[model samples]
Target: MASASTDVDFNKIVKQDQTLCAICHFSWVQKDARCLPCKDKVHIFCSDCLRQLAHNDESHAEGILFCPVCKMAHRWTEEGVASFPRLDLFNSNNDDDDDGNRLRMRSRTFVDAPPNHTRSYVEEIIVSVLRNLHNQEIQMIQKINETAANHMKKVREQRHKLLEEVLMFYDEKESELIDIIREFAAFEKFSKKVGETNKKVTKMKIRLNNKANSCFHRNIEFIKDSSLADFSIGLNKKEEEFKVSKELCRLPTGGRVCNTSFFNDTLYLLTEKFGGSLFFYKLLRYQMKTGIIESLHEWNNSIKIEYKLAVSVNIYLLTVGEIRVQRVTETEDDDGKFSCTFSTFYDIMRRKNDTTSFVHIIGYEKGIVLCCQDLDNIFTFKKIKDPVKQKWKISLNLPLLKIVDMRINSSQLFALFTENLHYIFDLNSGKILNKLKTSTGSPREVLGITKYRFCTKILFQSGCCLIGNDFVRLIDKTEDGVSSWSYKKIFDLYHTIEYGKCSEGIIAFLILDKWINTVYLKYIKC
Candidate 1:
């Protein structure tokens, strides 16, 4: 029976066999669905089981379903089976009948057999569902990647803007800080300058105080006898009595007295009636016995007839009209005789123009006459040279204005004027060394022998007197405007005069009356 079964037509059996599973080698009756290409039959159980196997291992299942017996995948669908061409095995006239039948059987059998290994139906279904879910998950991941990329881009943009804003804020703050630093630097510089100025002022105040004390001590001897004869007299004449008179004297021209100055031990009186006539009187010796009144040689032809005289150690200077200067000297043999040694005539004349018309004789030095003409011109004249002839030899023409009076101290020249103008010039270089101006009023007169170490008493037309040492100390003014004697004060002897032997000293001037006098007291060194 086994031989007969083996001899049975295997080709026919295989071709007719529709009872195997395509995915797994299972009986056709066990699977519901059949693989058409393979012509394998399987039961309902096999179909579900094959599907389950295919789902569980989809990569391997795709290959298995295409082929069963030969392990080759089906090239065509079941619908093409009827028209599908088969390979030729033998020729009709050839004597190879056995070989042909064996080839046909092998080929037919290969086309109908199913592959091995079936999976559970439930498991296959679960695998298919999982595959679908995996595909959906991949799509969701792609979307999430895109959204993340967009968010990152937005964050970068916002960060860039924020960084820019922060930089701008810092720039503005830096600029403000720089300005504040500059302001602070400027304030520091200003404060330093103020401190330096304060120090200078303090030093000046201390020096001035010392000078004031010295001047107070010298005044005691200066006030007693300021006349040249009295100055020449020794201090032993402390008990000597001198006469004081207010008696009026008449001039040769019958003019009443207007002003007077004692020069070379002689009294020189000026009369208003004579325009500028000068009367000279000699000081005679009483011999402690006989008293005598003596006459001095006088010149009635003196220029302009009415003028003011300024006396120094051995010379008398007179100013007549605008820019006119004359010098009077005592004759060597006449004891009290006087003569005019030199005179200057000005070419330009402008009234009330103080800058061009005024001539002030400040002092004398080493036979050289020191004087200031007008506001800017300072002249020095040799003893033998006429002022007009030496005009081209003027020492300096300092640029200044409103000068009222001037004085010389050593190598420095001190000038005082209105607008609080004060100038100190160097004698050697003729350059201005220092300058000071007052804010209150113009200086009426500069009275002292030293510079930066003496008292300056300024008389204002408004009747105010300003007193100080190298600086303004006090101002005393009268209410009335008409009084020429509007200002009055007492100056220490040391500050007012050069001689240091003076006792108690006070200088009182009546500007309206044109009277000047000195009072003497005891000396105190402190």
Candidate 2:
């Protein structure tokens, strides 16, 4: 009576215990081939099924086959999964209250899934071996919570410091304005007689001219902390180097470097391809910190480089020299570091206007596309999408006059000049917000605006009458106040300025010394 029967129902037990493929109907007899990437011992279906899934996907052109089950789930090669922990069939070390998926099996108990009544079960040994991973996940989640708490604490502290900075900034500017107002008031009190008032004004003017003469124009190198001062010209060549990615960008042998632009810490080098387009042949990204040069994009021959090119966040590169194409669209997902992973392209459909001039494509910058027909008085303001039409792209218009020398500031503002009148356009809507006449004479539109200086709240406007001259203008406004960007400071560079770009705390300029026939690269940190 104590001895158990030796002959049992072997076929019945085999049918009950054998693992079956989720895809293939075959009962897998081998204990191996569990998907290693998955925490639970997910049975790997036959390779034929996996192969079929990969080829059937029409969009998998990049050859990066994704897991069929879920986008978040990943699968490991079955052949290489041999080193993973083996199945433990009879482990008693399992929680009884566990009710999670078997892939992350916390118990050896078999549970039936609904619908087809399929049983999902795996040995407890799998969980025991993968217990370290579960523990690590718990630790990571705790660390993330702690980091978020710390970030919130720091943000509160930063808010106070930022308020102080803004207050101090207004204090200095307001004080200067008050002094100027008092000076004008004193002019009225000087004398009622015309001769006496003219004599006093001449003396005041002479004194002001003398004060300006005393501060002689000085150009010197700044070794450190040159944020709002003269640009500290140099590169950290010891730590960083520059190289180009030849795979994506093609640069022919002995190709002459034509132009350069720097924005968002990435330097764009425009080079002319031999036996190809004489204008912009290729666009390359020079990541100075890493000293790597990769192709930004190989533009079609249609984009001819112009004296001025515009860069903005709305479009990758609108300065597609004179956008000849009636349809304009762009995105910057391919831009390194500054690119948003989500691609945003807009449709810039242009209606033929016989009264307008040629389509002047400033140049491509970020993702924003801005187009305006000169004589139409209808400025096209396009964005990524329009829910109104349930389409991926949208084309809209903004009412604006003939505006030129359009340049982007650090924020969503475009500075444009029409004669002596300066206008700030709302970036997204492209509406001309305000206009102020410049006292610094007409800003040299040929040179355009120098963008923002690194991290500082300063903008440089090219003001020299001659080409290849560097002029600095620090423009600022608080809140919604209407203020003119007066002539503040004119910092000049000796070398002829070829091209300049500024973004993300770095300002770069490509300069050429005609006398020496030498080209130089200058960059300043904010």
Candidate 3:
């Protein structure tokens, strides 16, 4: 009978290719439901379906569950696993060697009689004990189920209290924020008249947060009077955690400033000369400590209609229709003589559009590396040769197009796109490491971004500061070691930001006061 039943079940599985669950009555593609060893073929759709049956079978309240359809005890676990992971299978006292004194796991279906005992007498004694043991199991499971229900009820009540506490926390934080805002508004209004008399805000030396770059130990707090404020994300909301914004100096140019770069503590600003000037453009190097023009030179004939400027250590590389490296000796004072010489450094031409491109330079091992952005791709050129007649050759290429901003470290490149995306590329392997969209939050430590349509980047001591129309996001590239690195954002927001540059942790932005239609150079520490 068993053989005939097994054959019929096999044929049904082979021909129909599915089985209907005995518990749920659902068709499944598995060869057969996990069933007990029985002549009658009973199907259990899946492990979950059988588990539901075991949990709800009140008849087994204090005993082991049996098959619902066949009422036969069998292995319910899935194939290949020895036991369920949640079960505690350890035994302090083992019963592997039996001397007819105690019945064990196998004694449920078959008993082993000792040689000294009569078989019939042994069988009668074992059957009587088995009935009593089975009743004990029923009582144990009933207590277990009752304890579980009572504990779960207590946990649910506590969880409801926890939810209420969380909501209260959020409400308290919101109220405190409103109070701070009111306090700042009143203070600023009171100081309005005194600020117009003799206003002078001295720029302070900005210190870099040389701490490790991980979000594990940060306490995030937002504080902005205007926009989605700057979070002084640090170990604590300490006074040193946040930066002070002060007036640095009014820009030398009243017309406008463009293509700005900062290296060391010096500021390099490109200003166009208008209204009867000898040159079309003038590049000024201003010292931050003295607020005086260190050097001013005519840079008209060397650039095209459009150009980009980058300062690396002491070398200044400019690009537009051509690439020029500003002579390092330009730092020396001429007394009265003016000598601002730039040798044409644009030699390699990979494409026609490469002539007019955005350029950035960084000091590599011995020479300098020139990073250029064409219409289709980004090409990096290494200055392989020495001092005499320096030449730039193509070193590597990355097929990342529409890069609005590019910031380079020793081993990685942070490339930003106008489409609200940013990519980090491993320069050593020329492979993309990570890609992320500019957003305010994420699953991991969400480094923030303010992806305006027009955004630019300026490198700081340990990171790159991304500047937009009103928001600034700092990308910290602090490597845990020389071989590895991580990203962090010290984000802030402002108003009417036109151009920006950073050195160490000091940032200077040319902000236009829309109320008065005037521009001011402001400095802030990070």
Ranking by TM-score: 3, 2, 1
User: Which candidate do you rate higher for TM-score, 1 or 2?
Assistant: 2
Alpha carbon lDDT of each predicted model: 0.36, 0.38, 0.43
- TM-score for candidate 1: 0.30
Worst 10 residues of 3 by lDDT: 201-210
Alpha-carbon shift of residue 115 in model 3 (angstroms):
64
Q: Give the residue spans of candidate 1 off by over 4 A.
A: 1-271, 274-308, 313-324, 331-358, 368-402, 409-413, 416-419, 427-429, 442-517, 521-526
Worst 10 residues of 1 by lDDT: 1-10
Tens-place lDDT digits, model 3, residues 85-195: 211111214556331222222112223344476668777887678757745665666677678677777657755655565566567656655665565565456456446
Model 1: how far residue 423 lies from native, Å = 1.4
What does the lDDT read for residue 406 in candidate 2? 48
Candidate 2 residues lying further than 4 Å off, grouped into runs, are 1-261, 273-280, 296-315, 318-366, 375-404, 428-431, 438-469, 475-506, 513-526
Worst window of 10 by summed lDDT in candidate 2: 239-248
For candidate 1, the per-residue lDDT at 370 reads 38
Q: TM-score of each candidate?
A: 0.30, 0.33, 0.40
